[model samples]
Target: MEIIVTPTAEHLELDAARLNSHPQNESRLFPDGEVYVQLESVADIESALVVHSGQPCPNQGLAYLYGLLDLLTKHDVLITLCFTYVPYGMQDKSFYPGTVNYARALLDHVTRYPVRQVYAIDPHFSHRDWVAEYPVSHLHAFPLVQQRVNADLDDYVVVGPDLGAVERFGIPSYEKTRNGAYEVELEGGLDIEGRNVLVFDDLIETGGTMVAAYDRLKSQGADTVVAAAVHGVLDEGIQRVQGTYDGLYLTNTIETDAGNVATESLVQTALE
Candidate 1:
């Protein structure tokens, strides 16, 4: 038997509904915001699949994951972690003085557990040395976003929010653009005038650059602006832009109130 555990029931609801035979743990939270797992009593459990939707409280989620690992390891069960959004993944570099390598730190901490494998979606790390303990499956977010974009939107041009995203969205060189904290810069002097645009990025934390780019595209006469990302860690960024955007679509990676595109199938395949 394979048991699926997550920090919250909501995180694994879609998966559980799909995999009806797999046993699962429902997480409960105390008044103090501590997380606890309620496991269904079973025998002959061979492995534990810990699914994590790293948002709202990533540390608390980690605590639950660690606790589950401890319990399962005592029974000599194999363990795998399917973390949709790696916490502090963007902190891959010490940009300047007083900065810490949070990516390394987080990877180091998680690998301390006896995890047989780790699965993540488009982790931002440029190096893989931190994950030396176990094999990691790095999944791409582009195909997921592309399928949704093609199915939902018509008459839209995909806009990469940064130079790095140009290849991901397959935008033409002339159409490529770059977004900074407060300004949007054109790579090939392209104009978004009178065109419907879809802004794409790997993740949305604070939504600063995306918001700025949306406003700038409108200023340059874009007919409509929509956004899509792999992870939606909105962090007041969605509230900051309120009613201005036509739509916002995201995968169930970090789990916000955004329109969710299913990723449970991806998770199932990863487990296999």
Candidate 2:
């Protein structure tokens, strides 16, 4: 038997229903904020697949993942970990004195487990190339973004929130926009007047950067500004400035209470 586990209830909701037919596992939190996982049943599981949508609760997903891995290890089952929104992917490098490379730290921690493979969907990596003992796949959501943008394309241009996003998207030539605490700046001198613009990135958290970009695009006379991201962690900042965006699109990389575009087929592609 193959067992599929979701780290939390939110994750279980995001996972495909076909996978849900099997026994499900749940995690509970003690009053002290400690996590304890309850595996329903796995008497004779041959392999395991973990499908986890991220959480705002810091390290909660990781703790739950480790717990599942421990159980699978005891069963000597091959395991595959699929994290729709990889935690700490933004902290891929050391930025200041005594600061740890959290991205690497996360990878190292998971590598210690008997995980046969790992999928970090739409990861924000400092480097494209990596070598790990087990297979580590960096899946992209560009196709999904492209589909969303294709529905209506007229006088449209793909935009990047920053220079790095521009480089990653690799659109031959595009408008450049940057976000600052107080304001945003548009560079590259591409005229956006009366143009429909589509901005995309790997993830959107807090949305301060997207808000800045959206505001600047409108000021430059952009006809319409739509934003899309692989992971939608639209926190307080987005909540505060929801009306600033013309249309907001997000993938199911992370499960939230809000309605988001489904990403199950895209995830299935990675699994196959």
Candidate 3:
């Protein structure tokens, strides 16, 4: 029931007050570029939940993660790893001949350490078999983001950016057309005319999908468009989509100024 946070996870500001609190874990280099880890207090722990933000700085963050995992396994502590934004998550869908799936490869590397279970928030992987093996627990920030956002907002509809989402969310979604403008066919009994639109995806690296959805929704006579996602690895995407959408939000999965929503509720239930 103890929560051990990595340096990168500090951005999440996770609300795990219900879980047992322990001394912070420390990490530094050995001058050879190798990572070293330590517990601020004595390591008499039994069960632990290691929360880490694994994007933006995957290599450095992973060094800390592996070091911490190595240290904990020595104490025979039961571990459940939580990566707010799973690394190498994008390559799980479709494969190229003679190439390896980095997503599965890296996740396998993680499971190598005596880890019991791993969890992530809205992983980008769509490969059914790979996802079935170890997905993000099918947990998402949609409901939480929806609940926290202003309810007095305009009439809203969730736009699935892909066919998988269109089937999954059972709502009208947008697809790309030959002309580069997104097309919304108005399925699932929801129309974009004069109503606010909400479109989301697992990750928002460039914000093109969201911004495009906004443009298409407005073209279809929608009032306003709110863009959202679970992870906002938004390097330059933030500046690009800032003023265009009526609202923009990302869960605090990565360390960014724009992560307005929190991801604690989705995780607490599993830990307890």
Candidate 4:
């Protein structure tokens, strides 16, 4: 299938049209040639993705869904919504007071049309088995994320911002730190006094935890602190750390204005 991708000033643009000649749909074919045509458009595709749900804050996953919907609507494609939930994240339980039924509500909304499956990436609760109610496709991201990390780094310590992330990240070499905070430690807890450090996480929101990690690493004698995440959810008031760290990297799973971050090129390449 041929795909065309466009980028709006503030959103994702997708237009897809089938280009194969068919006997039944002669009207869609070019007069001089024999190419069938279909059109699909999508805007802001990165907004609704939610890879992580703890530590920093909630990155709005709805925006990513909106963009996906736009593309699916145009192409008449069907998919299952996929996500991951941290152990103590708000979406973990429905028993908590005032907690929203995120799974149900999200499924209800997405299934309104052509969604054929629903997937969760290592959801916290065993009861998450209920997600199968709508033809679900539950999957895990740890293996994928681990594969990516293995390809990127030869030897690096995995640092979790807090206890919750320690379990969620599930890296055997993971180290836990305070919530929304960070600390630097050298060999044997001694100060590094001047070294480079790499910190990785699943999501970043409000820039609090990341910023705190940066500060802690610097204080522990690290000369530079570089951070990376799968999702960059720079909520309002948290964008102030745009250029503060040595390097802040994130995927295009969510749109942000931070420099030096990277996004998946699938959509872009598909358009070309």
Candidate 5:
């Protein structure tokens, strides 16, 4: 399959697409607030894309993606997408009527094209069945996490921070109460005295949950309490997670400082 890394997704440096080959892939804007885009040499081929929908400019990213899709769909190219960081993925649920589930909304918009499959690294969703009708599948980052832990971390047990994580990872978990968007309280017991603890989850936004987990584990006499997550989207989290924990391990999904694992290999894992 011919692979494409869109102009919006150029920062990932995936081996699949060579940006230099498509010198004509450029963008401009109209006098009005509109975007003009062009992607060269991607027509009439089966293709895979690499892109991340990170913030501060998410609308621009999707606009560029839609541009590329418009050009490629002309020749009926089969497409697969690697959304490294899904935009608005955390908004997967709605508690009230008329509340939009942005996750589902984005999925609908993404599948409007002839996409065969979609691979995301540990997508944040409350349930899988809610999106089973879509061609989206999660790329498990836990295997890579296990490899990293086995190579560097010793005498540590993987602990899920809440029931959702417990169901996803099938490990011992902590009871958590969320007071607000940035406030977290954890309650649980484990025989972890003098042993290292690794709290695993999909994403961390404000770092409140991880910090609460760290405090709970340390209070139980654990030697080291580390935080591990696939996506490090720390908007206001760097301070809360940096000095408070023994260590933080994350993947290159969002290009954060704590990202130690390369998600390139894990992308290939999706094909398997």
Candidate 6:
């Protein structure tokens, strides 16, 4: 059985190639008895299944996805659509009035295609049931991120930028207080002091919040500060705080020129 991977700017080919080596009963239905094909902007088809990682930006648009759908439909091939949500910062719930339901709207738009399955890493949804509109697969990136952090760091406390993340990420986190600007408070007014801190979130847009968190952790006597997210959307402010934190780990859910402090080692495990 062969597995073909579609190419995007993201460095997922190595991991995909690794996933191809393992055989599954699901491969029996493929044409020529081969199960994998990879689709990329550059034509280096190494697997039996075609995987296309076309740019989905508005300018580039969904033309590639549409084309792939047409090809799959014509050939009667079952296709799975896999993507992550860092490029577009998905705040599942609206914080203020007149804000758009970005996550739900995006899913609705993407599901309009004829893909059989949808795979997502670390979505910002409040509940899994919110994605029930589409009859496809959705994978959470939190457990994967947690596993990576847990493997790398011991004697560490999880830090959340705010209370929202504490609930969303399902971990104990320190809330950044408005007054101190560089202070994070734990439950019962306890502050994280002299402890190794691991800050986890779904995405990092600019480095503002993260940088502030780093300072706050330092002020509170956190021995070291490490920030990890599923997506690294280093926008304009990233330059200001690139070196502020000790380590910034992220997954290859989006394409970015900004190098990650660490790449997720749990890619292989997540596939399982």
Best lDDT among the predictions, by candidate number: 5
- lDDT tens digits, residues 166-204, model 6? 666666655555445333344322267878888877667
**How would you encode candidate 4's per-residue C-alpha lDDT over 31-98 as one tens digit per residue?**
66433333322232322221222223232234333444555566555333334332233354477787
**TM-scores for candidates 1 onward, in order:** 0.78, 0.83, 0.83, 0.51, 0.87, 0.66
Best TM-score goes to which candidate? Answer: 5
| Residue-by-residue lDDT tens digits, candidate 3, 1-272 | 78778877865556431212233433265557665667643266888888877777788888888878887888888888887888777776447788777778878887888777887777776435656675346566678778756564655777765555654445567554333333223323237697777777666766566666666677778887777777877667765566678777778888888878878776665586
lDDT comparing candidate 3 with the true structure:
0.69
Tens-digit per-residue lDDT, 1-272, candidate 5: 66676544455556665333323434255557466665555554666554554543667767767776677677677777777778788888785898988888888887888877888778887355688888887778888877887777797888887777876667888888999988888887988899988889888888888888888888899997877888778746755777787777777777665678778776665444
Per-residue lDDT tens digits of candidate 2, residues 1-272?
A: 24364544255333432212222333266657777765646546777667666556547867877777787788787777777777878787788999987877787888788887788777787344443444688677778767776776765888777666855666522344435543455555447799898877777776766776777778789898888777766566445335677776777676664425666665565556
- The number of residue pairs in model 4 that clash at the backbone is 14
**If both were scored by TM-score, which would come out higher, candidate 1 or candidate 6?**
1
Can you write out model 1's per-residue Cα lDDT over 76-183, one digit (the tens) per residue? Answer: 777787777887777877779999888777767667777878888777663446555447778776677778877877788877666556544455323334455534
2 or 6: which has the higher TM-score? 2
User: Candidate 4's C-alpha lDDT?
Assistant: 0.45
Candidate 5, position 100, lDDT? 88
User: Could you list the CA RMSD of all candidates, in the order they appear?
Assistant: 4.9, 4.0, 4.7, 11.0, 2.9, 9.4
Which wins on lDDT, candidate 4 or candidate 5?
5
CA lDDT of every candidate: 0.67, 0.66, 0.69, 0.45, 0.74, 0.54
Off by over 4 Å in 2: 1-3, 9-27, 126-134, 152-155, 172-186
| Candidate 6 TM-score over all chains jointly | 0.66
The best-first sequence of candidates by lDDT reads: 5, 3, 1, 2, 6, 4
Off by over 4 Å in 3: 14-27, 30-33, 40-42, 150-152, 167-170, 177-190
